[model samples]
Target chain A: MKRAVFKNNWVAALMVAPQLLIIFVFFYWPTSQAMYWAFTLEQPWGGGNTWVGFDNFAAILFDDLYWYSVQVSVVYAIGATVLSVGMALILAVFVDRQLRGFKAYKIGMIWPYAIAAPAVGLAFRFIFNPGAGIMLYLNDAFPGAWDPNGNGTHAMIMVIVAGAWKQIAYNFIFFLAGLQSIPRSLLEAGAMDGARVLRRMRDIQLPLLAPTFFFVLVINITDSFTDSFGIVDTMTGGGPARATNLMVYKIFNDGFQGLDYSGAAAQSIILMFLVVALTVVQFRYIERKVHYT
Target chain B: MIERTPILNIVTHLILLSGLILMIFPMYLVLVAASLDLKDVSAIPPKMFPGDQLWVNMGVAWEKAKFGEKFLNTFIVAFGVVVGKIVLACITAFGIVFFDHRLRMPIFWAVFITLMLPLEVRIVPTYAVAANALQPFQVFMDVTGLTWAINAVTGIEVALEWNLLNSYTGLIMPLVATATGTFLYRQFFLTIPDELVEAAKMDGAGPVRFLREILVPLSVTNIAALATIMFVYSWNQYLWPLLVITDQSYGMVAVELGRLVPKITSTGGEVAKWNIAMAGTLIVMVPPILVVIFMQRWFVRGLINTDK
Candidate 1:
C-alpha cells in the first residue's frame, strides 16, 4: 500500500478540510450532543437539563410502547429483507440462465431502485386504496375484505410491501452479479450429474452465493430501519393506531413531532448502536469482498 | 447456456414477467390516475386508460400545490448536494490517497463514522445545529480572540445568530457529510496504480499539476458516476428537508408530494383528489427516474462500487 505523499502539508490539509469540516460540524457535533442528551434528562418544555444517567434508558426500555416498537421494527426488517432478497434471488437465477430479453429486465428492474421511498409509499397507497383501488375489486366478491388504512396487520403488510418493492432492484443487481461470477462449469457439472434446476440451485448455487446473500440481508435490514422513515411517514404516518410505528418512526414521532427530545434522543442512540454494530460487520465483509461476489 | 430445460425456461419467463408486472403496475396506476380527473380516478377499479386531464392535473398540482416553487427548492438542494459532496469527496479522497498527513487516519475514520450515525439517527440534535449554526462560528471566533478584538476596535459587539434553517445552505450543508462519495472516490483513486504517480513525479509534475493533468481526467467517469447516484439520493430525500425547512415557501417536492395527497375527507364532504396526488408523485419521480435511466451504467457502477 505505497501512497504518494504530497510534498506540501498545507495543500494536503486544505484538500481534506472541507469534508472534515462538514462532518465535524454536522455529523460529529450532533452525534456528540445526542450522546450527551441520551443520558441526561432534557425535557422539551424546561430549559435546564438535569443530568440523570441511565434513567432515560431505563424508561425507554421499560416502556411497553418501546418494546412493541422493537417487535414491530424486527418484524419489518425480517419481512422486508426476506421478501426483497428472496424475490431478487429468484429473478437473478432466472436471468442468470440467460433468459430472452434479460437485458430489458435488467434495465426495467432498476427503475424501482431510483423511485423515492415516498413515491413508493404513495404508489402503493393508491394501489391499496380502500374504496377505489384494485383491492376494491377483491372486496366485490366478498364485501369489506381488505383495507390497509383501518386494519393494523394490513397496514404493516403494506409498509413491508412498499419497503421491499423499492429494494428488489438493488438486491437483484447484486444477486445477478454474484450469480454471474460463479464459474459456469460448476453449473454444467451439476446438470451433467442429472441435478435438476431447483436441485442445482440449492446444492451448487446457493452455497456459493452465501456472501452476497448475507451482504444484501444486512443492507436490507439496516435500510429498513433508516430508509423506511419515508415510507412510514408518507404511507401510514406510523398510523391506524400506531400500527406501523417502527423504532425509527418512534424517534421522529416522539422527538420531532411529539417534542420528547430526551426520549427521542435515547431511541436514536439505541438505533444508532444497532446500526453501528451492523455497519462494522458490513465494512469488514465488504472490504474482504471488494467485488461483492 | 449450460443445460436444455424447456419447461424450466418457460416457467422462468413466467416468473420474471410476473415480477416485472408487479414492478410496473404501480407506476402504471399512478400514470392512469394522473391522467384522469377526480371522477374517473374515483370510479370503481380506477381508470385503466390514460385520460385527457394529464396536463390539467399536472397544472393543478403545479398551481394549486405550488409545485413550481417546491420543484425549484428540490432542484437547488439536490444540485447543491451533488456539487458540494462530490467536490469535497474528490479532494478528501485525493488528500487521503496522495498525502501521508498525520491527521489523515483520524479524518478518514471520522468520515467513516458518519456512515453509522446516519442523519436519521440524530435528527433532533442535528435539527438544533441547523437551526443555530452560529454557535460553532461564535465559539470559533471566541477561541481565536477575534470577537474581543473586533468589539474593542469597532465599539460594536456582534453576536452571530445566523440560522441555516429553510435556506438552501441548510438543506445542502448537513446532508453533505456522507462518506459514500468519499469512499467511492478513494476506492477509484486507489486503483490509479503507484506507477502513474511515480512517473508523474519523475516528470516534475507538482501535486496539483499531476492531479489535474492525470488523476482528474482519469477520474471523470468516477466523478460522473458518483454525481448521478448522489443526485438521485439527494433528490429523493424526504425527512431532512422536512426537519430543516420549516418555511412553507421553501418546500421540497418530495415533502409537497406527501402533502398533495388529498385526504379522504370524513362525512364524504369531498372526495380526495387522487388525480393531483398521482400527478405530484409522477412529477416528483420524473427527474430521478430520468437521471437513473440516462446514466444507468454509471449509476449501477457507482452503487456497486460504493456498496453502501
Candidate 2:
C-alpha cells in the first residue's frame, strides 16, 4: 500500500544512490558504449572510431564463422540443457520415491551450484585428460580413438558434459520442488485404475509437472547460453580450430585477443538481445501458467 | 504413499546411486589427481590412488602459484560484493516499497536490466570504463582551468589520479548492483503487513529508523540465504577480475588455476604435470563448496526462489 509513505524525496534519493550510481556507471555506461561501438568502426588499440552504420552487423550477419559460432552455441546450449535437465528429472523422480537418506542426496546434489564454472572445467579437465586422470584407461584400450584435445567433436562433448554437470544440480532442485507440488490424489487416482508407476507418471505426474518442466527449460537454456564461458575458457579455450567456440567466448576472444572492438561489440549486442528475447519469452509464456501452485 | 514394490525401490536406489557417482566422479578426480606425484601423474596409465606427495603438491600450489594472495583477494572481493549488495538492496527495496518516490519503479527496472546482459557480454567496454575512471576528473580540470584556479586560491599544484585498476574496489564495485537481490528483498517486504508500517509511523519513527529497527531484523533469514548465494557467485566470478586486474599480485584463484595447464613442452615430451593444477583446483573449490554444504538449506531455497 502507498499509505506507508515516507514523504521525502531527499531521503529516497540518498537510499537509492549507491545502486543507481553503480548500475549507471558499470551497467548502463558500458552497455551504451557497446551499442555505440556496435554501430561504428573502432580500433581496439588506437581507441578512435568512425561512425559506420550497420557495417559491423552486416559483416557479422554475413560471416560464415559468426553463423558457425551461433550454431555451435545453439547446439551447446541444447545439448547442455537437455542433458542436465533430463538427468536431473530422473534423479529427482527416483529420489522422490525413497525416504531413507533424502538428506544425503539433497546435500550431495545441491553442491554443483556452489562450484564455479571454472572449477567444474578444471575438475573435468583432470578427469577428461587423455594422459592422466579417469580417461587414461580408456585411452590405453583405444590408443588414439579417444582424444578430446585433438578432436573437435570430442572437445564439444567435453564442454557439453561439463556444462551439463554444472547445470544438473540446479535443475534437480527445481525438479524435486516440482515433483513435490504434484498432488498425491492424482497419483492415487491413476493407481486405482491399475496403472503402473510408469503409466501413472506418464499420465498424471508428467502432465501436472508440465509447468515446472517449462520453467526449467527456459532457465536451463538461458543459463547454458550465458554461463558456458567458464567451461569453454578452461576446458579448451574454445580450441581445436574454434570448434567449441561458443558465442560468448567468441566475444571475449575477439575483443581481448583479436582486438576487434567493433566486431565484438556487435556480437555482444546480438548476444544481449538473444538473452533479453529468451527472458521475454519465458515471462510471457509462464505468466499465464506459473501460478498453478 | 502409493504401492511401492521392493524391486522398484532397488531400481530407484540404483539409478540414484549412479547419478551420485556421475556427480561425485569429477570431485574424486580432483582428489585423486591432487594426491598423486608428478611421476605417477605422468606415468603410462594414470594412478587412481592417493600418492605420498599430496602435501608437497599443495605446498607448490600455495607457495609457488601464489594462491595465498589470490585467496586473500578473492575473500576480500567476495565479501565486499556480498555486503555491498545486501545493504544496497535492502535500503533500495525499503525505499521502493515503504517510501513514496516518483522514480521507484524506474530505479527498480534499471537495476533489473543487469540481469539480462551478463558480464561476458559487455566485458570489453566495462574494462574500458574501469581503466579510465580518472578521465572525468581530467576533463573537469580542463573545463574549469581548475589547476590555475586552485593555484590562485591556495598555491598547491596537484593532479588527480584514481588507480582503481588493480584494487579491491575495481573488482567489487562493478559487480555489486544486482536486481535479483533487490527483487527478493522487495518481494519479502511486500509480505510485511502494512499495520507494522503504520504502527512504526504512529510511533513517530522515520524510514531509516523503521528500517534499522524492524525491517532489518525481519530480513535476517532472507539476507543470510541471499548472502550465501551471492558469496558463491562473487567468489566464482571468472571474467570480471580477469578484465580489470592485470597485476599478478591481484590474480584470482579461478583465473590462475587456468594457467597451470601449460602447453606441450616439445613435440615428443610429456605435458606439464597436473598434480599441482588439480591441487589448486581443490583449493579453489573448498570455500564455495563449504559454503553450500554449511548453508545447504538456505542455499537451496535461495537459489530456487531467486531464480524462478
Candidate 3:
C-alpha cells in the first residue's frame, strides 16, 4: 500500500512539472519584474537605475494629466457600460419573444464583438470621415453641425459611441444566454399572479438576470478602461492634441512611445490599484444584489 | 394567453430593427465604398452605390500595401499561434486536473493571478525577453562554417538566418500562452467525472492514451468553441504586432488599415480620399465578421460557459 501511494505521487509530480514551468516563466516572473521596475528610474541606454522610492507614484498622483486621464476613463467606462448593457437587455428581451429569423439577427448582433478593435476603429473612422462620412453628410445637411475632430468634446463622444457600438453585441449575447437559462415556470407563475408584462419584467426578470448584469458590467468596465488603447491607438492615437486620451492610452504613450519606463510602470501600478479597488467594491457591495440562480 | 398584445410586439420589433440597422450600416458603407472609383469616391456626400473601380481600387490597395505577402504572413502567424495555444492549453489543463498533487494548487493560483495582470503591465519586460533572451537553437542550422550544426532531421531542415524581428515568428511567438484558454479548458476538464478516468486507469491507459482517446473526444464542443475564439483573436490582434513588427509588408491587416490615415497637419486642409480608406476598412473586417456569423452558436455557448 505504501509503495503504491508513493508511486502515484511521483507520477503526479512528473505530469505537473511542465505546466508549472510555463506559468513560472510566462506569468509569474514577468509580473514580478514589472513590479520591481516600477521603483527604479532606469535609463533606456544601459544606464543603471537609481532607487526613487514613491517618487514615481507621487509624480503620477500629482500630475494634472494623470488626473484628467483617470476622469476620462471613468466617464468612458460608465457611459459605455450603461449604453451597452441597457441596449443589450432590450435586445435580449425582444429576441426572447421568438421573432422569425431570430438566429440570423443573433448572429449579426454578435459579429461586431469578434472583429479586432483596431479594425473596428478603422471602419468607424472611415464611416465618419469628414468629407465622405455618412455622419458628416448628415451633419452638413443640418446647420451648425459639429465635426468629429473639431474639439475635444466631440472626439470624446465619438470614442464612447464607437466603444459602445462594439460592446453592445457582446452584452446582448450573454444576456440572451442568461435569459434562456431562467426556468419558464417561474415566469409563468408571475403571469398567473395577474402581474402585468412590465411588472413581470421589472419584478422577476430583472432580479433574475442580476448575475449576468454584474458580469457584463465588470467586463465592459475592464475593456473600456484597460483594453481600449488598441482602438484609441488606431483611431485617434490619443490625438487632436490628447483630446481623447484615457488611462490605458496614456500609459502606452508614456512607456512605449516616450520610453519613460518608470513613469509608465508607475501609471500602470496606479491603474492596477484602481481595478482592484473597483473589483473589491463590486464584490463587497453589489454581490449582495446578485440572484445566483 | 389573452394578456398578449400586438402593441408591445410592434414596439419591440421597431427597437430591434433600428439597432440592427445601426450595427450593419458601417459594414454596408465599406462594401459600397470599396467598389467606387476615385472620382466617385471624392464626390460630396459620397455615392452609396457600387462603382466601376472595384478591381482598380483593389489593385491600388494591394500594390500600395503589398497585401498578398502581408496576408500570407498573417495567415502563417495566426495559424501557428492558434495551433500552439490549443496544444499547450490542452496539455496544461490535462496535467493540472488528471495529475493531482500538492503543487497543483499553487500552480492554479499562479494562473488565476494572471487574469488580473493585464498585458499592458508586462509589455516592456516581455519585449526585452523576446529580443534578448529567447533565441532559436542553432545546433540544426544549415551553415557548417558558422559553428552551427547544419542537418535535416525527419526531413525537416532547420533554418536560423530568418531573424524573427520582421517575420512570422515575431508575430506568433509572444502570444503562445493564453490565460483565457487555460482557464476555459481547466473549467471544462473539471466537468468530466473522475470515474471515467479511474476506469481508463483500470484498463492500463496511461496519461497520454487517456487524453488522446477519452478526454479529447468528449471535449470537442469546448475545444471547438475555444478554437473559434482563439482564431478570431489571433487574426485581429493589433497592439503587440504594431509594436514588434516594423516592416509594413509583413504586418497584419489591422496595421495596414491604420496606415491608411495620413498624419494630421496644422492646416488640416488636404482633401483625403475617404472612400478608399472605407473600402480598406471593409476588407479588414470581413473575415472575423464571417467567422462570428457562421460560428456564433458555439461562440455564445462558450462565453456563457466560461464563468463556470
Candidate 4:
C-alpha cells in the first residue's frame, strides 16, 4: 500500500472487478472443479457423477502406469535441472570473464530463451533423426547406435536435452546477473592473493551464488514437471513403452484422450500438490534470501 | 580485468565459443535443414550447409500448414493477451496500491494465490470451465433456487451455456488470468515515491487522472517489458489451444507446428518431411526471437524483476 493514497471505494471496486472476475472464472472455478472431480466419480462429456471419497486416488496410486509417469517425471525434472543449471553456470562464468565480444555472446545465449520449447523439440528431433544429421554418421560407424523412436532411454535423453537447451538461456541470464552482483573487489582480492580463476570461482563466487542456484533449481524443477509437456508432446508423445509419459502429459492423455475424468483429476490433484509444495519451498527460500542479502 | 593470464584468456574464449556453439547448434541445423530440399535434407549425415531452397521450402511449408491463417489467429490471441493482461493488471494494481478499501487485501490475495496454480496444473477442469463459460451463472441461479422459482412461475426450465471453445475469448482470457503482470505492476508501484502521489492529490487529480497522467507514463518501460514476456508466453502456448480449439481454422502457430511435425507428408508416410517442418519452425520462431533481440533490455529486466 502507498503512504499517500486515495479513498474512493466505488472507483477501487470498479478497478479491481475485472481482474477478480477473470481469476474467479478461470483460476478459482477450475481449481474448485478439479477438487470436486477428484473426490467424485464423474463421466466425461457432462455425464452424471457419484461421490467416491478417495477411491480415485486409490485406483491411481495402485496403477503401475501412473507410477511410471511419476518416475519419469522425477527423472526428467532432475535431469533437466542439473543439465541446464550446470551448463548455464559454466557459460555464465566464462562470459563473466569479460572476454572479447562478451556482449555478442550474451545476446546469442539469451535468444534461445525466446524460442518456444515445442520449436526446440522439433529442431532437435531433426538433428537426432536416425536417418539424417549427426545421428546418421554415428549409426553408420556402428550399425544400430541411435534411434530415439526405438529406444526409451535415448528418447528421455533427447527430451531432456531439448528441454535444457531452452532453459540454459534463462538460467544463464540469472547466473550472469548473480555473478555480476558479487562485488568485484572479492574477485580482485582473490586475484591479488594469487588464487587461480577456477579456485576463486569455487571459493568465493559459487558460495555467494547459492541463492541464485537454489532459485534456478526450484524454477527448473517445477518447469520441467509442467512445461516439459510441449517438448514431450512434440518430440515423443510419451511413447516407446511409456518412457517419457511425464505427469503433465499423462494428465492430458488420460483426461482428454482416455476420457478418464476422475482418474486424471486425481492425478492432477497430486501434481498440483507437488507443484504447490515446490513453490512453497521456493517462496520460503526467497524470504530467507531477502534477509541474507 | 582481474587476471590477464594468456593461458586463462585463451581457455575462457575457447569455453565461451563452445558454449555459444552448443547453444546455436540446433538452430543451425534447423536453418540448414530448412534451406535444403527434401532429398538433400533426408540424406545420410544430412546437408550441413545452406542450400538455395529456403524460399521454396518456406512456400511449401506455408501452403501445407496453412500458416497464413494460423499466423493471423496467433497474432490476435497474442496481442489480445498482452493488452488484456496489461490493462487488467494495471487497473488491479492501481486499485490495490492507491486505495484504502477493505476489499483491497482480499483482492490482492485472490490474485496472489493464483501465482502458485499455473494453467498446466488444472488444465482439464479449466477446459471444462472454458467449454461452458456461463456455467457459473447457471450454478449460482440453481443453488439459490432462482431457477426453481422462475420455473414454477413461468413453467419454463432455464439453462444457460456460452461456449467459449474455438473462439478468441476462450484462448486469451485464461492465459491472461495469471497474476504475474499484476505482481510486476505492484512491485513497481510500491517503488514510486509518496511525495508524487501527494503532489497529485494537491493538484486535485482524481485516481484515474493520477493513473493516466502520472503512473502510466512512469511505467512505460515496465509495461513494454511485461508485454514482451506476455506476448512470447501467449504466442508459445500449445496445450490450451490444442484442447480448446477443435477446428483447424482456429489453430495457433505453436500447436500447428506440433501438428505439422508428426503426420505431415506429401506421400502420407510415417516419416514427415524434415525440411518443410524445419521451415515451419523457423517461420514460427521469427517473431518472438526478433522481439527478444530488439527489446533485449526490457525482456531481461522483465525476467529478473518479475522473479524478484
Candidate 5:
C-alpha cells in the first residue's frame, strides 16, 4: 500500500506466478492430501483407499504406544526448554554485565548454534560413551554407573542434554538481545537505590525480559517436538523399549517404515494442530509485546 | 560494571569459563577422537589430547563415506536453495508491494498460510508429490478431458510424469517452497522510501527497470543477510534429503553422518568406530560453521529478523 505503485496486472501476475505455483503444489497440495489420507485407509497394495471416517483417529487414540509417544514428546519439550532457556538466561545475564571478555564469550557461545542437531547428537554420543568418555571416571567409583544404550532413562537424559546443548546458543542470543534492549537508566536507578546486581536483575531486568522469555519458550517447545528427530534418530533411535519415540519420529516411522499411511496421516494432523495452536498464540500475544517493547 | 564486587567479578568469570567449557568440551572430544587411532579412541579411558593423526582420520572418514560427492551435493543443494529462494521471494515481494493488482492480498495470504504448514507435518504427501513433480498437471489433464483429446488427435495415450526423487531439483525445490524469504523481502521492501519509486517514475523507469536499477542494488545487505541464514538452513537439512535422495550420489553429509553412527542395537559384535564417526561429524560441520563464523554479523541479524 505504498503511495507510488505500478498498475500493471499482467506483469504482477507474471511475477507472482512462480511463488503461487510453488506453494500450491508443494505446500497446499500436500497439506490437503494429508487431510484426505488421515480419514481414509489405504490398501497394502496400490489399490484405492476406503473412507474410514474416524477409524484411524480412534485406533491411534486407543493405542497405548501412541499415548506413550505423546507423553515423551511433552516431557522432552518441557525438559529441553527448561534446561536450555535457563542456561541461556544465566549466560545472558552475566554477559549483559559487560564483564571483561564478554565479546569472546558471546562468540564462543553461539558456535553451537552453527552446529546441526544430529552432529550435536553424535558428538554427545561420543562424550557420553560409558566405556571411554568422561563418564568412565565416574564409572570407576561405581561400576555400571552410566549406560545410555541399555538404560532407557539414561538414553532420555542423554538426548535431552544434547538437544538442550544445541539450543543454548540460540536462546543466549535472544536473551542477550533482550537484556541489551532494557534501558540502562533503569538499572542505574536500581543501583542508585543500593540494589545489587542480582537484585536489579531479579526486580527490573527480568520483568522487562518476560516477553522474550515467553517467545523463546514457545519456540523451543515447538522445536523440541518437531526438530528433535535428528537427535533422537542419531543417538537413541527411540530405542530401549521405545523410550524416546517422539511424535514426529513416530509419524515418519509409521508412514515410511511401517507403511501405515492413514495412521501416520492422522498423527500428522494432530501434530499440525499442535503447531497451529502454538503459532496462533505466538502471533496473538508475542507480536503485541514486540510493538510494546 | 557499576561498582563491581571483586568476589562477584571472580565468580562471574568462573561461571562464564565453566559455561564455555561445557559448550566447547563436546566439540573438543570430537576433535580428540578424530585425531586418535581406533584403538586409542576406544581405549579404557578416552585419550583427552590431540594426536598427529587428525588429517589421517579425516581422510579415512572422507574416503569411507564418499564425502567428496556428499559435500559437493550439499554445496549444490545449498546454493540452489539460496538462489531459488532469493529470486522467487524478491520477485514475489516486488509484485506484491510495487504493483496495485487485485489478487495481491490473496497471494499474500496464500504465502502466509504456509507459515503454519511446515514440510515436516505433511511429509508423506510431500514425498508423494516430489516423487512425481508433474502429478497435478496429469490429474488436471485427466479431469479436463485434455488427455482424451490429445490421445484421440495424436493416436496415443498421454500420462505426463516426471519423477524428481534422487535429483538435485528434488532436494532443492521443496525446501525453497517456504514463506521465510518472501516475508523477509516484503518487510525490507516496505522500508524503502516512496520517493525512490516516484523518482524512478519521474525518470521514466518502468517496474522492471526500477527493480533492476533501483531496488536490487539497495537490497544487497538484506540479500547477504538472508543468504547466510538460508545457506546454513539448506546445508543442515536432513529429513527431506533422507527421504528423497536414496542414491549415494545425492546423499547429504548430515544424513550420511547420521548413518555413520553405529546403532546402539549393534553394539555387541561391532566395536563402534568413534574415531571415524567423530571425524565425519567434524567434516560435515565445517561448511555451515565456517559460513556462520565468517558472516557472523549478518547471520545473527538474519536469525533475529527471520523470527520477527
Candidate 6:
C-alpha cells in the first residue's frame, strides 16, 4: 500500500513541474520583485537603487492626487458593479419569461461584451466626440442638457456610461446562465401559488441568484479597477486635471510614465490589499445569505 | 402551460430589437464613416450613408498604418502566444495530475496563487527581466556562431536589439502561461476515470502513451473550447503588446490603426478622418466578431459546463 501511494505521488509531482517553472519565472518572480521594488527607489535608466523603506507608501498616503485617484476608483468600482449587476438581473428576469425570439434577445444583449475594449472605447469615442458624435447631437437636441466634452463632470459621466455599457453585457451573460440553472419546477410552483412574474422574481429568483450576483460583484469590482484603465487611458487619458484618473490608471502612469517604480509598486500593493479585504468582507458578511439550492 | 401573451411578446421584441440596434449601431456607423470622404466625417449629425471613398480610405489607411507588415506581425505574435499557451498549459496540467509527490501540493498552490495576482502588478519587474536577459543571450549566440540558425528558426536574433519589441516573440512571450487555461485543463483531466488508466496500464502502456492514445482523443471538446477562449483572448490583448512594442514600424493592426487615425487627423485641423478611423476600426474588429457570432452558442455552453 505504501509503495502504491508513493508511485502515485511521483506521477503528480512530475506532471506539475513545467507549470511550476513557468509560474515561478513569469508570475512569482516578477511579483516578488515588484514587492521588493516597493521599498527601494530606482531610476529608470539603470542606476544605483536607494532603499527608501515606506517612504513611497507614506508619500502616496499623503498625496492629494493619489487619494483622489483612490476615491475615483472606489466610486467607479462601486457604481459599475451595482449598475452592471442590476442591469444583468433585470435582463435575466425579462428574458426568463416565455417569449418569442428569446434566443435572439439573449445573444444580441450579450454581444457588446464580446467586442474588444479598445474597439469599444474607440466606438464610444466616436459616439461621444464633441461636434460629430451622435450623443453630442442628441445633447444638442435637448436644450440645457449637459455637454460631455464641455466640462470635467460630464466627461467623467460619459466614461462611466461607456464603462457600464461594456460591462452590462458581460454581467448579463453570467446572470442568464445562472438563471437557467434554477429548477423550472420551482418557478412553475410559484406561478401556481398565484405569484406574479415580478413577485416570483423578488421572492425566488433573486435569492437563488445570490451566488451568481456575488461572483459578478467581485468580478466587476476587480475588473473595474484593473481593466477600466484601458478605456480611461484611451478615452480621457485621465484628463481634465486628473479628474478621471482611477487607481489602476495612476499605477500605469506612475510605473510607465513617471518611472516611479517604488511608487507604482506601493500603489499595486495597496490595490491588492483593498481587493482582498473587500472580497473577504463580502464572503464573511454576505456569503452566508446565499441560498445554494 | 405558460401562456405567451401578445403584449409580453411585443415588449420582449422591442427590448431585444433596441439592444441589437445599440450593439450594431457603432459598427454600422464605422462602416458608413469609412466610406465617406474626410470632409463628410465631421459634417453635422455625421454621415448616415456610405460614400464613394471606401477604396481611397482603405488605401490611405493601408499606407498610413503600414497595414501589411503590421498584419503579419500581429498574426505571428498572436499565433506564437496561442501555440505556447496550449503546449505549456497541457504539459503543466498533465504533470500536476500525474506526477504525485510531497512537492505536488506546494506546486499546485503556487500556480493557483497566480490567479489572484493581476498582470498589472508585475509589469515593471517583468519588463526589467526581459530587457536584461535578452542582452547576454544575444552576445552568447554571436560568439558561439549559432546566430544565423537561431535567427532563422526562432526569430530571437531580431529581438536582441529591442527590435523584438514590435516583433512576434515580444508580443507572444509574456502571454505563454495562462492561469485560466491551466485551471480548465486541470479540472478536465481530473474527470478522466481511473478505470481507463488502469486498463491502459494492464496493456503495458506508459504515461505518455496513455495520454497520447487515450486522454487526448477524449478531450476534443475541452480542447476546442479552450482554443476558442484563448484565441479570442489573444486577439483582444492590448496592454502587453502596447507596452513592449514601441515602434510604429512593428505595430499590430489594432494598435497601428489606433495610431494612424489620431496621427493623420490631428494634423492642422484637417478634421480627424472619422470615416477612415471607423473603417479601420471595423476591419480590426471583424475577425473576433465573426468568431463570437459563429461560435457563441458553443462558447457560452462551454463556459457554463466547464466551470464544474
Q: Whose DockQ is greatest here? A: 4
TM-scores, all models, native as reference: 0.93, 0.92, 0.88, 0.97, 0.96, 0.87
- Give me the runs in candidate 1 sitting further than 4 Å from their true place: A43-47, A185-199, A287-293, B137-158, B262-270
Which residue runs does candidate 5 get wrong by more than 4 Å? B148-155, B266-268
Clashes of 2: 0
Please say which candidate is ahead in lDDT: 2 or 5.
5
Interface RMSD of each: 1.9, 2.1, 3.6, 1.9, 1.6, 3.5
Global CA lDDT computed for model 4: 0.90
lDDT tens digits by residue: candidate 1, B1-308: 66678998899889889988978988998999899978777677556889899999988888877988888888888889998977898889998889887788888887877877678878888898898877777877988999999999997786888788989898998889879888998988888878888899999988889878898889888888888888888898899988887788998878887777653222345656888888888888998888888888877878887875
Best by TM-score: 4
For candidate 3 chain A, the 10 contiguous residues with the lowest summed lDDT are A1-10
Q: Where's the lowest-lDDT run of ten residues in candidate 4 chain B?
A: B261-270
Give lDDT per model, in order: 0.84, 0.83, 0.71, 0.90, 0.88, 0.70
Model 5 pairs whose backbones collide: none
lDDT of 2 by residue, B1-308 (tens): 57867787777778888988998977886887888887777566667678877888999888867888899989988999899989988988887887777788788788777877777777888887788656445656867898788888999875666667888888988778557788888888999988998899899998889999999999988888889988998899987887787898888778887777763212445466688888888888889999889988776777766776
Docking class of 2: medium
**Model 4 per-residue lDDT tens digits across residues B82-124:** 9998999999999999899777788899999998878998999
CA deviation > 4 Å runs, candidate 2: A1-3, A43-47, A183-196, A291-293, B134-163, B263-270
The weakest ten consecutive residues by lDDT in model 1 chain B span B262-271
lDDT of 6 by residue, B1-308 (tens): 35445776677667667666765676677777778886777776756888898888877777767777877776776677666766667767776665556665676667766666566556676666555535445655777877978787888654464434545666666676547667777787787777777787888887777768887787776666666666666776767777877876667766554564452113365556666777777767777667766778766755654332
Q: Record all residue pairs in model 2 with backbone atoms less than 3 Å apart, i.e. clashing.
A: none
CA lDDT of A191 in candidate 3? 84
The TM-score of candidate 1 is 0.93
CAPRI verdict on model 5?
A: medium
